[model samples]
Target: MKTFVLTALFVTIAGLSGCDRSSQGFSLPQGNAELGEQVFVKYQCLSCHTMAGYETDTENLPGSMETPVALGGQVSRIRTYPELVTSVINPSHRLAEGYEAESDQSVMPSFNDVMTVTELVNLVYFLEDHYELEPYPRTDYVSPH
Candidate 1:
Protein backbone atom coordinates (compact mmCIF):
# COMPACT_ATOMS: atom_id res chain seq x y z
CA MET A 1 0.00 0.00 0.00
CA LYS A 2 2.77 2.39 0.94
CA THR A 3 4.72 1.59 -2.22
CA PHE A 4 1.64 2.09 -4.33
CA VAL A 5 0.89 5.46 -2.76
CA LEU A 6 4.45 6.64 -3.19
CA THR A 7 4.56 5.54 -6.79
CA ALA A 8 1.26 7.19 -7.61
CA LEU A 9 2.35 10.42 -6.00
CA PHE A 10 5.66 10.34 -7.87
CA VAL A 11 3.94 9.72 -11.18
CA THR A 12 1.61 12.67 -10.63
CA ILE A 13 4.52 14.97 -9.90
CA ALA A 14 6.48 13.70 -12.88
CA GLY A 15 3.56 14.26 -15.23
CA LEU A 16 3.39 17.90 -14.18
CA SER A 17 7.00 18.41 -15.20
CA GLY A 18 9.32 17.77 -18.14
CA CYS A 19 10.51 14.23 -18.67
CA ASP A 20 11.25 11.61 -21.36
CA ARG A 21 10.96 7.90 -20.66
CA SER A 22 10.28 4.91 -22.85
CA SER A 23 11.78 1.45 -22.96
CA GLN A 24 11.46 -1.59 -25.19
CA GLY A 25 12.59 -5.13 -24.43
CA PHE A 26 15.97 -4.45 -25.99
CA SER A 27 18.94 -3.55 -23.81
CA LEU A 28 22.53 -2.77 -24.69
CA PRO A 29 25.74 -3.63 -22.86
CA GLN A 30 27.10 -1.01 -20.47
CA GLY A 31 29.17 1.50 -22.39
CA ASN A 32 32.07 3.87 -21.71
CA ALA A 33 30.90 7.47 -21.21
CA GLU A 34 34.43 8.78 -21.89
CA LEU A 35 34.44 7.40 -25.41
CA GLY A 36 30.90 8.69 -25.80
CA GLU A 37 32.16 12.21 -25.14
CA GLN A 38 34.65 11.80 -27.96
CA VAL A 39 31.92 10.57 -30.28
CA PHE A 40 29.79 13.59 -29.33
CA VAL A 41 32.58 15.93 -30.35
CA LYS A 42 33.41 13.94 -33.46
CA TYR A 43 29.85 14.24 -34.66
CA GLN A 44 29.67 17.91 -33.72
CA CYS A 45 26.42 17.43 -31.84
CA LEU A 46 27.01 20.80 -30.20
CA SER A 47 26.05 22.54 -33.40
CA CYS A 48 22.37 22.10 -32.66
CA HIS A 49 22.33 20.65 -29.16
CA THR A 50 24.02 21.58 -25.90
CA MET A 51 25.04 19.32 -23.02
CA ALA A 52 26.42 20.28 -19.65
CA GLY A 53 30.14 21.16 -19.51
CA TYR A 54 30.54 20.81 -23.27
CA GLU A 55 31.82 23.97 -24.97
CA THR A 56 29.64 25.58 -27.63
CA ASP A 57 31.11 26.86 -30.86
CA THR A 58 27.92 26.64 -32.87
CA GLU A 59 28.48 30.03 -34.41
CA ASN A 60 31.81 28.91 -35.82
CA LEU A 61 30.38 25.71 -37.22
CA PRO A 62 29.33 25.81 -40.87
CA GLY A 63 25.71 24.93 -40.14
CA SER A 64 24.22 25.81 -36.74
CA MET A 65 20.70 26.09 -35.50
CA GLU A 66 19.50 29.43 -34.24
CA THR A 67 18.45 28.06 -30.89
CA PRO A 68 20.46 25.14 -29.60
CA VAL A 69 18.58 22.36 -27.86
CA ALA A 70 19.67 21.52 -24.34
CA LEU A 71 20.48 17.87 -23.65
CA GLY A 72 21.13 16.93 -20.02
CA GLY A 73 20.21 18.40 -16.68
CA GLN A 74 17.85 17.83 -13.76
CA VAL A 75 14.75 15.98 -14.95
CA SER A 76 11.58 14.94 -13.18
CA ARG A 77 11.98 11.31 -14.21
CA ILE A 78 14.55 8.85 -15.45
CA ARG A 79 15.44 8.94 -19.16
CA THR A 80 15.63 5.25 -19.84
CA TYR A 81 18.38 3.87 -22.06
CA PRO A 82 15.97 2.61 -24.72
CA GLU A 83 14.36 6.04 -24.99
CA LEU A 84 17.71 7.75 -25.27
CA VAL A 85 18.81 5.26 -27.91
CA THR A 86 15.63 5.83 -29.82
CA SER A 87 16.09 9.57 -29.49
CA VAL A 88 19.54 9.39 -31.03
CA ILE A 89 18.64 6.98 -33.79
CA ASN A 90 15.20 8.34 -34.60
CA PRO A 91 14.92 11.92 -33.43
CA SER A 92 11.57 12.37 -35.12
CA HIS A 93 9.84 9.96 -32.77
CA ARG A 94 9.07 12.75 -30.29
CA LEU A 95 9.63 16.38 -30.93
CA ALA A 96 10.66 18.67 -28.11
CA GLU A 97 7.33 20.11 -26.88
CA GLY A 98 8.04 23.83 -27.01
CA TYR A 99 10.17 23.76 -30.15
CA GLU A 100 7.84 22.03 -32.59
CA ALA A 101 6.85 25.35 -34.09
CA GLU A 102 10.45 26.41 -34.67
CA SER A 103 10.92 23.76 -37.29
CA ASP A 104 8.47 21.71 -39.29
CA GLN A 105 10.41 18.64 -38.26
CA SER A 106 13.38 17.85 -36.06
CA VAL A 107 16.35 19.88 -37.21
CA MET A 108 18.73 17.09 -36.25
CA PRO A 109 20.26 15.39 -39.23
CA SER A 110 20.63 11.63 -39.55
CA PHE A 111 23.90 10.10 -38.41
CA ASN A 112 22.80 6.53 -39.05
CA ASP A 113 25.06 6.19 -42.06
CA VAL A 114 28.16 7.60 -40.40
CA MET A 115 28.03 6.88 -36.66
CA THR A 116 29.29 3.47 -35.57
CA VAL A 117 27.28 1.23 -33.27
CA THR A 118 29.96 1.55 -30.60
CA GLU A 119 29.77 5.32 -30.83
CA LEU A 120 26.00 5.26 -30.48
CA VAL A 121 26.22 3.07 -27.39
CA ASN A 122 28.91 5.24 -25.90
CA LEU A 123 26.94 8.41 -26.60
CA VAL A 124 23.93 6.96 -24.86
CA TYR A 125 26.11 6.12 -21.88
CA PHE A 126 27.42 9.67 -21.73
CA LEU A 127 23.86 11.01 -21.88
CA GLU A 128 22.68 8.54 -19.23
CA ASP A 129 25.35 9.82 -16.90
CA HIS A 130 24.37 13.46 -17.28
CA TYR A 131 20.63 13.46 -16.56
CA GLU A 132 19.94 13.87 -12.84
CA LEU A 133 16.49 13.18 -11.44
CA GLU A 134 15.08 16.17 -9.61
CA PRO A 135 14.27 15.60 -5.94
CA TYR A 136 10.60 15.04 -5.28
CA PRO A 137 8.92 17.09 -2.63
CA ARG A 138 6.49 15.05 -0.58
CA THR A 139 2.93 16.23 -0.52
CA ASP A 140 1.46 16.98 2.91
CA TYR A 141 -2.03 16.00 3.96
CA VAL A 142 -4.12 16.72 7.02
CA SER A 143 -7.22 14.93 8.19
CA PRO A 144 -10.42 16.93 8.28
CA HIS A 145 -11.77 17.57 11.77
Candidate 2:
Protein backbone atom coordinates (compact mmCIF):
# COMPACT_ATOMS: atom_id res chain seq x y z
CA MET A 1 0.00 0.00 0.00
CA LYS A 2 2.83 2.38 0.92
CA THR A 3 4.77 1.46 -2.27
CA PHE A 4 1.72 2.09 -4.44
CA VAL A 5 1.20 5.50 -2.87
CA LEU A 6 4.82 6.47 -3.46
CA THR A 7 4.71 5.28 -7.07
CA ALA A 8 1.61 7.34 -7.79
CA LEU A 9 3.18 10.39 -6.19
CA PHE A 10 6.31 10.05 -8.31
CA VAL A 11 4.31 9.76 -11.50
CA THR A 12 2.29 12.86 -10.67
CA ILE A 13 5.43 14.84 -9.85
CA ALA A 14 7.08 13.98 -13.17
CA GLY A 15 3.98 15.01 -15.11
CA LEU A 16 3.71 18.37 -13.35
CA SER A 17 7.45 19.13 -13.45
CA GLY A 18 7.68 20.26 -17.04
CA CYS A 19 5.34 22.38 -19.16
CA ASP A 20 4.17 19.82 -21.76
CA ARG A 21 7.68 18.41 -22.11
CA SER A 22 8.13 14.88 -20.97
CA SER A 23 10.48 12.80 -23.12
CA GLN A 24 9.07 9.30 -23.67
CA GLY A 25 11.96 7.90 -21.61
CA PHE A 26 14.75 7.74 -24.22
CA SER A 27 17.98 9.48 -25.21
CA LEU A 28 20.01 10.04 -28.37
CA PRO A 29 23.70 9.79 -29.25
CA GLN A 30 26.25 12.35 -28.07
CA GLY A 31 26.19 15.31 -30.48
CA ASN A 32 28.73 17.72 -31.95
CA ALA A 33 27.65 21.37 -31.59
CA GLU A 34 29.74 22.35 -34.61
CA LEU A 35 28.01 19.77 -36.83
CA GLY A 36 24.71 20.88 -35.33
CA GLU A 37 25.42 24.44 -36.44
CA GLN A 38 25.87 23.16 -39.99
CA VAL A 39 22.56 21.32 -39.70
CA PHE A 40 20.86 24.53 -38.50
CA VAL A 41 22.14 26.38 -41.54
CA LYS A 42 21.30 23.51 -43.90
CA TYR A 43 17.69 23.53 -42.74
CA GLN A 44 17.50 27.31 -43.22
CA CYS A 45 16.05 27.81 -39.72
CA LEU A 46 17.10 31.45 -39.73
CA SER A 47 14.55 32.09 -42.46
CA CYS A 48 11.88 32.51 -39.77
CA HIS A 49 13.90 32.90 -36.60
CA THR A 50 16.64 35.15 -35.29
CA MET A 51 19.72 34.11 -33.33
CA ALA A 52 22.86 35.98 -32.43
CA GLY A 53 25.94 35.26 -34.56
CA TYR A 54 23.76 33.77 -37.32
CA GLU A 55 22.31 35.42 -40.38
CA THR A 56 19.29 34.71 -42.57
CA ASP A 57 19.50 35.15 -46.34
CA THR A 58 16.27 37.12 -46.70
CA GLU A 59 16.70 37.45 -50.47
CA ASN A 60 16.72 33.67 -51.09
CA LEU A 61 14.14 32.51 -48.54
CA PRO A 62 11.52 30.03 -49.75
CA GLY A 63 9.00 32.19 -47.94
CA SER A 64 9.17 34.71 -45.11
CA MET A 65 7.35 34.80 -41.79
CA GLU A 66 5.18 37.79 -41.00
CA THR A 67 6.99 37.89 -37.63
CA PRO A 68 10.33 36.33 -36.79
CA VAL A 69 10.64 34.14 -33.69
CA ALA A 70 13.64 34.96 -31.54
CA LEU A 71 15.81 32.12 -30.35
CA GLY A 72 18.57 31.86 -27.69
CA GLY A 73 19.18 34.88 -25.54
CA GLN A 74 19.06 35.63 -21.81
CA VAL A 75 16.46 33.35 -20.22
CA SER A 76 15.04 33.36 -16.68
CA ARG A 77 14.24 29.65 -16.77
CA ILE A 78 16.67 26.94 -17.78
CA ARG A 79 15.76 25.20 -21.03
CA THR A 80 16.32 21.50 -20.54
CA TYR A 81 17.49 18.96 -23.15
CA PRO A 82 14.16 17.12 -23.35
CA GLU A 83 12.29 20.41 -23.70
CA LEU A 84 14.50 21.46 -26.58
CA VAL A 85 14.05 18.09 -28.31
CA THR A 86 10.27 18.33 -28.00
CA SER A 87 10.35 21.92 -29.30
CA VAL A 88 12.08 20.80 -32.50
CA ILE A 89 10.18 17.58 -33.17
CA ASN A 90 6.66 18.52 -32.11
CA PRO A 91 6.60 22.26 -32.55
CA SER A 92 2.82 22.58 -32.33
CA HIS A 93 2.64 20.84 -28.96
CA ARG A 94 3.01 24.24 -27.33
CA LEU A 95 2.91 27.47 -29.26
CA ALA A 96 5.19 30.34 -28.33
CA GLU A 97 3.42 33.16 -26.43
CA GLY A 98 2.27 35.49 -29.20
CA TYR A 99 1.81 32.70 -31.78
CA GLU A 100 -0.87 30.79 -29.87
CA ALA A 101 -3.80 32.67 -31.45
CA GLU A 102 -2.61 32.23 -35.05
CA SER A 103 -4.87 30.43 -37.53
CA ASP A 104 -1.93 28.30 -38.66
CA GLN A 105 -1.14 25.44 -36.28
CA SER A 106 2.56 26.04 -36.49
CA VAL A 107 4.82 28.06 -38.77
CA MET A 108 7.65 25.54 -38.34
CA PRO A 109 7.29 22.63 -40.72
CA SER A 110 7.72 19.03 -39.69
CA PHE A 111 11.37 18.03 -40.03
CA ASN A 112 10.86 14.57 -38.52
CA ASP A 113 10.56 12.95 -41.95
CA VAL A 114 13.40 14.84 -43.63
CA MET A 115 15.84 15.30 -40.72
CA THR A 116 17.91 12.35 -39.56
CA VAL A 117 17.83 11.51 -35.85
CA THR A 118 21.52 12.29 -35.63
CA GLU A 119 20.96 15.74 -37.13
CA LEU A 120 18.23 16.38 -34.58
CA VAL A 121 20.56 15.42 -31.77
CA ASN A 122 23.33 17.56 -33.20
CA LEU A 123 21.07 20.54 -33.77
CA VAL A 124 20.01 20.40 -30.12
CA TYR A 125 23.64 20.56 -29.08
CA PHE A 126 24.18 23.61 -31.28
CA LEU A 127 21.07 25.43 -30.03
CA GLU A 128 22.04 24.73 -26.42
CA ASP A 129 25.13 26.87 -26.91
CA HIS A 130 23.17 29.99 -27.79
CA TYR A 131 20.99 29.93 -24.65
CA GLU A 132 22.29 32.09 -21.83
CA LEU A 133 20.55 31.28 -18.56
CA GLU A 134 20.45 34.06 -16.02
CA PRO A 135 21.73 33.10 -12.60
CA TYR A 136 19.30 33.10 -9.71
CA PRO A 137 19.85 33.86 -6.02
CA ARG A 138 21.05 30.91 -3.97
CA THR A 139 19.10 29.97 -0.87
CA ASP A 140 21.06 29.88 2.35
CA TYR A 141 19.95 26.88 4.32
CA VAL A 142 19.59 27.09 8.08
CA SER A 143 20.98 23.96 9.74
CA PRO A 144 18.91 22.82 12.69
CA HIS A 145 20.98 21.60 15.61
Candidate 3:
Protein backbone atom coordinates (compact mmCIF):
# COMPACT_ATOMS: atom_id res chain seq x y z
CA MET A 1 0.00 0.00 0.00
CA LYS A 2 2.86 2.41 0.86
CA THR A 3 4.66 1.63 -2.42
CA PHE A 4 1.54 2.21 -4.46
CA VAL A 5 0.93 5.59 -2.83
CA LEU A 6 4.52 6.69 -3.47
CA THR A 7 4.32 5.67 -7.13
CA ALA A 8 1.06 7.56 -7.59
CA LEU A 9 2.51 10.67 -5.98
CA PHE A 10 5.56 10.51 -8.23
CA VAL A 11 3.41 10.17 -11.36
CA THR A 12 1.28 13.12 -10.32
CA ILE A 13 4.31 15.34 -9.81
CA ALA A 14 5.80 14.32 -13.14
CA GLY A 15 2.58 15.04 -14.99
CA LEU A 16 2.24 18.47 -13.41
CA SER A 17 5.83 19.37 -14.23
CA GLY A 18 5.26 18.45 -17.88
CA CYS A 19 2.23 20.72 -18.00
CA ASP A 20 4.26 23.64 -16.61
CA ARG A 21 6.93 23.13 -19.27
CA SER A 22 4.47 23.61 -22.13
CA SER A 23 3.39 26.98 -20.71
CA GLN A 24 6.98 28.26 -20.28
CA GLY A 25 6.89 30.34 -23.52
CA PHE A 26 9.80 28.50 -25.01
CA SER A 27 9.84 28.86 -28.79
CA LEU A 28 12.58 29.19 -31.40
CA PRO A 29 12.47 31.98 -33.96
CA GLN A 30 12.23 31.15 -37.66
CA GLY A 31 15.87 30.73 -38.74
CA ASN A 32 17.64 32.33 -41.68
CA ALA A 33 20.36 30.23 -43.30
CA GLU A 34 22.35 33.27 -44.43
CA LEU A 35 22.44 34.75 -40.95
CA GLY A 36 23.23 31.33 -39.57
CA GLU A 37 26.30 31.04 -41.79
CA GLN A 38 27.48 34.40 -40.51
CA VAL A 39 26.90 33.19 -36.95
CA PHE A 40 28.88 30.03 -37.69
CA VAL A 41 31.78 32.08 -38.96
CA LYS A 42 31.52 34.67 -36.18
CA TYR A 43 31.72 31.82 -33.67
CA GLN A 44 34.64 30.22 -35.53
CA CYS A 45 32.92 26.83 -35.74
CA LEU A 46 34.85 25.90 -38.87
CA SER A 47 38.02 25.81 -36.81
CA CYS A 48 36.84 22.56 -35.21
CA HIS A 49 34.09 21.16 -37.40
CA THR A 50 34.23 20.39 -41.12
CA MET A 51 31.02 21.29 -42.96
CA ALA A 52 30.58 19.75 -46.35
CA GLY A 53 31.12 22.20 -49.23
CA TYR A 54 31.54 25.13 -46.89
CA GLU A 55 34.92 26.84 -46.86
CA THR A 56 36.41 29.12 -44.28
CA ASP A 57 39.31 31.56 -44.38
CA THR A 58 40.02 31.02 -40.70
CA GLU A 59 42.77 28.52 -40.02
CA ASN A 60 42.91 26.07 -37.14
CA LEU A 61 45.15 26.96 -34.24
CA PRO A 62 48.48 25.26 -33.79
CA GLY A 63 48.32 21.69 -32.39
CA SER A 64 44.68 21.45 -33.45
CA MET A 65 43.91 18.44 -35.61
CA GLU A 66 43.55 19.09 -39.33
CA THR A 67 40.32 17.14 -39.35
CA PRO A 68 37.90 17.32 -36.49
CA VAL A 69 34.25 16.30 -36.35
CA ALA A 70 32.68 16.24 -39.78
CA LEU A 71 29.21 17.75 -40.01
CA GLY A 72 26.88 18.06 -43.03
CA GLY A 73 27.19 15.79 -46.11
CA GLN A 74 25.65 12.36 -46.46
CA VAL A 75 24.77 10.91 -43.08
CA SER A 76 23.70 7.37 -42.33
CA ARG A 77 20.99 8.93 -40.22
CA ILE A 78 19.66 12.47 -39.95
CA ARG A 79 20.19 14.47 -36.81
CA THR A 80 17.09 16.32 -35.65
CA TYR A 81 16.92 19.97 -34.59
CA PRO A 82 16.78 19.13 -30.91
CA GLU A 83 19.83 16.92 -31.26
CA LEU A 84 21.78 19.78 -32.83
CA VAL A 85 20.70 22.19 -30.10
CA THR A 86 21.68 19.72 -27.41
CA SER A 87 25.04 19.19 -29.06
CA VAL A 88 25.79 22.92 -28.97
CA ILE A 89 24.40 23.51 -25.50
CA ASN A 90 25.69 20.28 -23.99
CA PRO A 91 28.42 18.84 -26.14
CA SER A 92 29.38 16.03 -23.79
CA HIS A 93 25.83 14.74 -23.51
CA ARG A 94 26.52 12.19 -26.24
CA LEU A 95 29.81 11.26 -27.86
CA ALA A 96 30.06 9.80 -31.30
CA GLU A 97 31.39 6.26 -31.62
CA GLY A 98 35.22 5.95 -32.01
CA TYR A 99 35.55 9.54 -30.74
CA GLU A 100 35.64 8.64 -27.07
CA ALA A 101 38.83 8.98 -25.07
CA GLU A 102 39.87 8.14 -21.52
CA SER A 103 37.49 10.82 -20.30
CA ASP A 104 33.85 11.02 -21.36
CA GLN A 105 33.98 14.86 -21.55
CA SER A 106 33.71 16.52 -24.93
CA VAL A 107 36.61 18.43 -26.48
CA MET A 108 34.13 20.89 -27.98
CA PRO A 109 33.34 23.77 -25.69
CA SER A 110 29.72 24.47 -24.76
CA PHE A 111 28.25 27.39 -26.70
CA ASN A 112 25.50 27.93 -24.16
CA ASP A 113 27.30 30.94 -22.77
CA VAL A 114 28.49 32.48 -26.01
CA MET A 115 25.60 32.15 -28.44
CA THR A 116 22.22 33.84 -28.32
CA VAL A 117 19.05 31.77 -28.59
CA THR A 118 18.37 33.11 -32.09
CA GLU A 119 21.88 32.23 -33.24
CA LEU A 120 21.51 28.71 -31.92
CA VAL A 121 18.19 28.27 -33.66
CA ASN A 122 19.60 29.59 -36.92
CA LEU A 123 22.69 27.42 -36.70
CA VAL A 124 20.59 24.32 -36.24
CA TYR A 125 18.52 25.25 -39.24
CA PHE A 126 21.60 25.80 -41.38
CA LEU A 127 23.09 22.47 -40.36
CA GLU A 128 19.88 20.55 -40.87
CA ASP A 129 19.71 21.76 -44.46
CA HIS A 130 23.10 20.23 -45.29
CA TYR A 131 22.39 16.61 -44.40
CA GLU A 132 21.54 14.22 -47.24
CA LEU A 133 20.09 10.73 -46.99
CA GLU A 134 22.74 8.20 -47.89
CA PRO A 135 23.05 4.47 -47.35
CA TYR A 136 25.79 3.26 -45.05
CA PRO A 137 28.51 1.22 -46.72
CA ARG A 138 29.00 -2.41 -45.73
CA THR A 139 32.44 -3.40 -44.62
CA ASP A 140 34.22 -6.23 -42.82
CA TYR A 141 37.10 -5.58 -40.50
CA VAL A 142 39.87 -7.97 -39.41
CA SER A 143 41.54 -7.46 -36.04
CA PRO A 144 45.23 -6.71 -36.39
CA HIS A 145 47.44 -7.94 -33.58
- Please give the lDDT score at residue 71 for candidate 3: 84
- By TM-score, the best candidate is 1
Error of 3 at 87 (Å): 0.9
Off by over 4 Å in 2: 1-25, 58-64, 101-104, 137-145
Candidate 3: clashing pairs of residues: none
Q: In candidate 3, what residue range of length 10 has the lowest lDDT sum?
A: 18-27
In order of TM-score, best first, we have: 1, 2, 3
lDDT tens digits by residue: candidate 2, 2-29: 9999778766756664533336464455
lDDT of each: 0.78, 0.78, 0.72
lDDT of 3 by residue, 36-107 (tens): 888888888887777877774346732434456788888778876677778888888998765554578776
Candidate 1: give the clashing pairs: none
Candidate 2 backbone collisions, by pair? none
How many residue pairs clash in all the candidates, one count each? 0, 0, 0
